[model samples]
Target: MAADTAEENGDAASCSTATLSKDLADLPQDVFLLIITYLSARDSVACRSISRAWHAAFTSEDASLLLLRWHFSRSRETRALVSGWDSRSPGTGRESIAAVFAKVARRYHHLRQAKPRLIEKIDVVQEATHRDLHRGVAPWDRILRWNDNKAIFQYSDPTWCMDDGLLIYPGLDGGQYVAYDLETQRRFHVPFDNADKTVRRVRLACGVLVIEWCERAPYHQLNEREVVHRTFATAYDVQRAQSRSSSSRSAKLAIVRSPSDDSSAWTIVFRSEWKIHFLGLPLNATDRFFSTHNGTHYALYIWQPHRSPWGDDDPIEQLAVWNISFPSAYRPSLDPAGTKRPDADLGPSVIQRLTWRELEIIGLRQRHTPAIRELAMDENNLYVHEEEHRWLAGTQSSIFPPRHHTVRCTGFPLVGIGPIWYDECCADGDVHMSFCPRSGSTAGLSFADADAEAEAEAAGNRAPTPLPLTSYRKSTWPGYAPCWRHEEFPYLTVSDMKDALAGVRVVARQCFMVEALSVFVMPRISIEADEDADADTENPEARFADEMWTELMGKGRIYGDERWVVGEDAEGRITIVRF
Candidate 1:
């Protein structure tokens, strides 16, 4: 009987081993898919190498769609494009849904890694006059000249704007602009007849091109000798222009194409004039201006420095908001000969000015008054960086080299014109403060140092934090959260880093003195990692930022989209990297 029990135990043990060693490929399709849903996009793709069965399952249509929805569903454009894709019937020679998903995933992977498959350089000096070209005056120089030779502040109008594969920049003559399509390799000329007007800023978004230009107008008072500067904004239909140009080019194939062929392409859909001054002070070069649009609504932000009523030397900053209709429902013909009405002051009829005192009263209750260091705006809110300086105990009288600084961020909602509201429980809930060792260092402070300082101070250790040579928030008011929050690198100084919100990723281009420029593509949030967890651990956000950051040899304004990064090389030529 004992021998029989032993034999039965041995047989049962062999059966259990067999069950444990069963191939993962033997799992049911539903079970396999469920497991895949738990894996990241990268891991799911890597699993194809496990076995032929795993490969087949991963490459299946259902798996591809599932991964896409799970990983890349943040991009509405991607969702819309992939919605109609039918893998079972991809048509005669078209690729399957799985193939398309692979291609897209690989593209985004390359983008996240900052690895581009192709880089193209285009010379925008073609239209520049011979004299200007000989004098080394490039298109970028002309843009600065248009802005009254003022240094382009972070909040100032960009030198150029790129969107939807279209790159728009000023031509040599200042009377015309060039819209180059990256996909079609075609150039469409957008020309204006006003010789006295110069394009100050150009913004392209949502299939519409908005140009802000300044023209010399006669002073309202005849006795006043000062020239009146009037700013006007005009919106053109970019899609309509491209379509018209394509049709015209195809019809005139036999005839040599010239700038005239595309001159009529751009149609002025909307036009309005904006006030150039506030509170009797003319808007000067020091003032900041930037415009943004979200297809339907177009908004403009202007930061002007005003003298305090109390006669203090420190100027009180004023931020003015303007919300204008992008494409007016009523289209009135304003052609030279057509009926022309007085330039309508559509908005800005009420300018909401927020001062530093008002900001302090609203939320930021600090011991020392802080100065606004940098400003950035999106379609939703305006981001402000405020810095307060503190002198060391023994170095109070010293003028330089030894001071502690504290930096914080404040976000104000961009609601049209009304009283701003905030959460009573957490009025300064969005406020995040960090300490810096160096004083007046504009190069930017790294978060590593901030993290260390916070920890040292939290431990009840009053020891002075060591300074290295480098020195390199949430609110609830409807749609009024902080504009950006990245775990790896926070508090990007506007002076060195240029950032753009491209769908799910924030593409930041940082300029290093020795490295030229480095591009970092960061996701808004990590899928596999906890936000509150320490970044030193095996955090995907930290790993991705470290791995994907790429340095390029260039020094110019940086602009990018989901797939491409466009900047100027050392030679001042426009360089585009396609992933």
Candidate 2:
């Protein structure tokens, strides 16, 4: 009789709890959203385990919604969960916020361990003619393809993109882009968005390029076969008496292109290599260069290097920013300052801008103590993103540690042990260098300051601080900032070409970023507190794990040993569970 009474009490308690939770569930969505909004990531994840009915209530929403809320709430685990959902949703992006939340909330620790750095980028096209008033050229040229391959003899650098496990070399002319696989020797030309212009000079950073192009025929389009849509800036320029040629071909272009079209008159603009230390993919890159005309919207999209192109990088939603078009009369092909124009030269300088996304992604590796496995940047400092290794001076023999060191000219910093920053801080050496905690920190230097430091390499002097490097703008989350942005005059979109810009339009500057990563964790994970599991500094891993549990209901597996660990779900959710 006593046992029966106890069982009845427990059952009654459960029923009452379930009934109350059910009532809470029935409240207006805004009310529920509001009620739950105040909860911490830990509390929110715990809510799902509140009761079976509550689980049914919250778990019903797409995980992304909750994850999004988590991000807004500044939950690192929640951000990771939301990020894991990246490229997962096809069109609508997500269905059930609860489902998305559940998927990542569980791995909140992993996300914190494998936190992604927000890379900033800038793209500008410089232009010159009987036109505007600016000594320093901005990438802003209204570039299009011409008819004959011989017509435009100029080119730009290759901006790197990923597709089908092949590296996309987006140059001024798609004809020159080379695709190859380490496993397979397969190679192919990356189709141009516009077929009319020929490539000239090109520069690279983080496996990308800062390219310059010369116009060919009226309607030159590279990546015509690509699914993206674009818009231009100017219909016609009034350079006193410049004539408006047949440019109807420039408007209403198609997406796809034929292979044999023989991209007309393309050449590389210039190339460059990365200069700043980095990890991950890259933050932003000078990998690609540009310019534009009046009233145009130019945009540069950065692609993440993933195991599977279809799975890792999203086709859309990766674009950095929009800008103006390339100007009418500047060309990298032409020699500086009235040099005699060559038959091979494209024309006078038109537009000049560099997207710095490569540095952002590549920042992942250099955040921690590194072992130089392999890494590479582009030439000309335009753009660069690559992974390689080199020898380093060590106490023992030349030892290749596990971590890697990196630098990108685009501008960003990270530290880590693994493939991303936040892994380890290596010691200083002739070739190998690491960050040493200092008493004071400074800011305010330009990319040019880095250039000057390089020029003074013989002197071995400390370079000035750079504001842009420190200017990274974090998401709503803290410690995440300084995303570079460079916009052009006129903003263009695919829809605009279909509806507006029928005859007149403008172009402006654009921004992009490079995303670098390290195999290292930005912050320690799963460190638990003995006194209060809610707060502990010694055990980052425990804290990470607990935080993840709170976001994900305290479930999931751990990786590595006590010394090191990593967690990324099959869904690409990163979890860190260290004891």
Candidate 3:
């Protein structure tokens, strides 16, 4: 009798299996892809083990592309690289799609979890050359001040910029520049005649390097009444320069120049004198001076402090925008003196100016003076982020006062055709704001207390636990409505870290933070924080696990892109973290 009952149970199990198979086979392609889109990448990949029909659907190109687009819609770089793979090649079977999907999924999973597959460091200043440059010069003579009996080196804030996967910075000798391609692991050195000047800031984009430098006025022209220094911006074309293999051991010892000795390697496409004065005061004394560029458009933003000459008048601050067009051909005749010609029609043009009064008239009413926190630019629009601080009456205060923070984004079109728009969003004082240039989006953290009644109704009398929330807003065009979303992020928050936050990016609905020494990636959506879960534990086929690099601890001045995080260590080394 027991054997008969066991036989009946076995038959029932077979019937259930047959039913699932038939149902999966009957599912339409569009419906199947739609269902897969809702599942996580790991779960979708694991669905192939269910049955032949399930495996076929999950392995199809249509399914893979759908999942990639849905999960990584905000990541244009990832989508561009993954979508170019052809799964219909000769030896590649239908399973190729699944394999590619799994690989891409794992890559981003590592990124989101702050686990890098590889960590590489490159010394910006060669040890031998560093010693040679400081051989005879005293620490005080080289702009180094002694604070607390320790030599404090004074230099620009961000001495480097990363674009198109290349880390470009001024060479220590000031006669050359270094370009290290993070992807190719190759280095290129472009020489320029910056012998007598000090490089204040460096920017690179679209194979062109824009350098801002200041030099002492010629002795013959120097006087008490005249300006003591001159500043200029010069653009160099370094696209065709020869690159050297950086994989060799000797490459790490010194900056090596390429074999090409082309005298015209420093093609000056744009050169203009930059006036450092604003409102009868030197701009270096102002609140902020920011400059950025896309391949086609260049933008310079200056935000001055609020001051009132008349005590009874309201304080006035100014923001000026300069739009410079990059011409493909270099024109020597237009700029014969190597200075900006005011009479010339083709040069940097002041397109827009916004003052405190004008901003107030445009509905950005502020109770306290606003400070410019960040400035970003793209091909079409220039974004200015302003924050106002107001102390709260009753709140727990830490190192910083508990205050309400408000963000206002004023976007201006580069082409000067569309109406200028302004959007305002507010966040709790504790939230750290981050901006993404690629998507024109801003994200921050928002915290709320748990609703006891709702938690009891859902969890059946279990105690409620607070959840951390992420608030995101995308900048919209003139005629479109703004996009905003609030999602639960159970992984980490701004208050949890002790290091200074450098940057933040939101991809695939996951928050990634670039901190001084580490990259913090938010985990997948879950109600509970699973400390034991690996980065790719959900995917059984994952090739790598979560990795931590303690060597990256002292690296500050952090920056990141879609796949790499670049930081500058205390000893002036460039650390690249690849996921």
In candidate 3, what are the lDDT values of residues 1-579, reduced to their tens digit?
A: 999999999999999998776675368886676566557777777888899977887877677656654454324322333333211111111224356566556666675565677778765543235332111101111111123222111123455666545677656554366766664465666554556655556777666677765453332232243333344556665453232223443322122232233311322234433333221222132234556665555565444334444534443445455555534233332343646444434655556666667656654333233344445666677766554323212111112422333446677666654667677654431124322112122222211222443455367532222232121222222212111211122111211111111112422221233222233332222111234555323312111122222233232234555466666555566767776
- Model 1 error, position 114 (Å): 3.0
The model with the greater TM-score, 2 or 3, is 3
Candidates ranked, most accurate by TM-score first: 1, 3, 2
**For residue 425, what is the lDDT in candidate 3?**
51
Superposition error at 435 for model 3 (Å): 19
Query: Candidate 2, residues 278-331: lDDT per residue as tens digits?
Result: 111111121222321112322232332232335544221122222212323433
Instruction: Assess the local accuracy of residue 443 in candidate 3 as a C-alpha lDDT between 0 and 100.
Output: 24
Candidate 3, residue 474: Cα displacement in angstroms equals 2.7
Candidate 1, 1-579: lDDT as tens digits: 999999999999999999888877678777766777667566777888899988888877667656665555433223333333222111122234455556556666765554677778765442124222211101111111112322211232334567766788655554356777664466677644446554566678776676765544332441233332455556666663332222342222211122233322434343433443332223244344444544444554444433345644543444555555423433221332325433345432323455557655656432222244444455566555443323211211123411333344556666644344332111112115332222112112223354675576468543222223242211111232222211112222222222222222323322121111233332322122223544233212112233223322233345655656676655546777776
Instruction: Note the clash tally of each candidate.
Output: 3, 299, 0
Which ranges in model 1 have alpha carbons more than 4 Å from their true place? 1-60, 67-78, 81-95, 125-157, 163-166, 171-175, 180-195, 205-208, 216-228, 237-268, 271-323, 326-557
RMSD of each: 13.7, 23.1, 13.4
Per-model TM values vs. the true structure: 0.52, 0.28, 0.51
Clash count for candidate 2 is 299
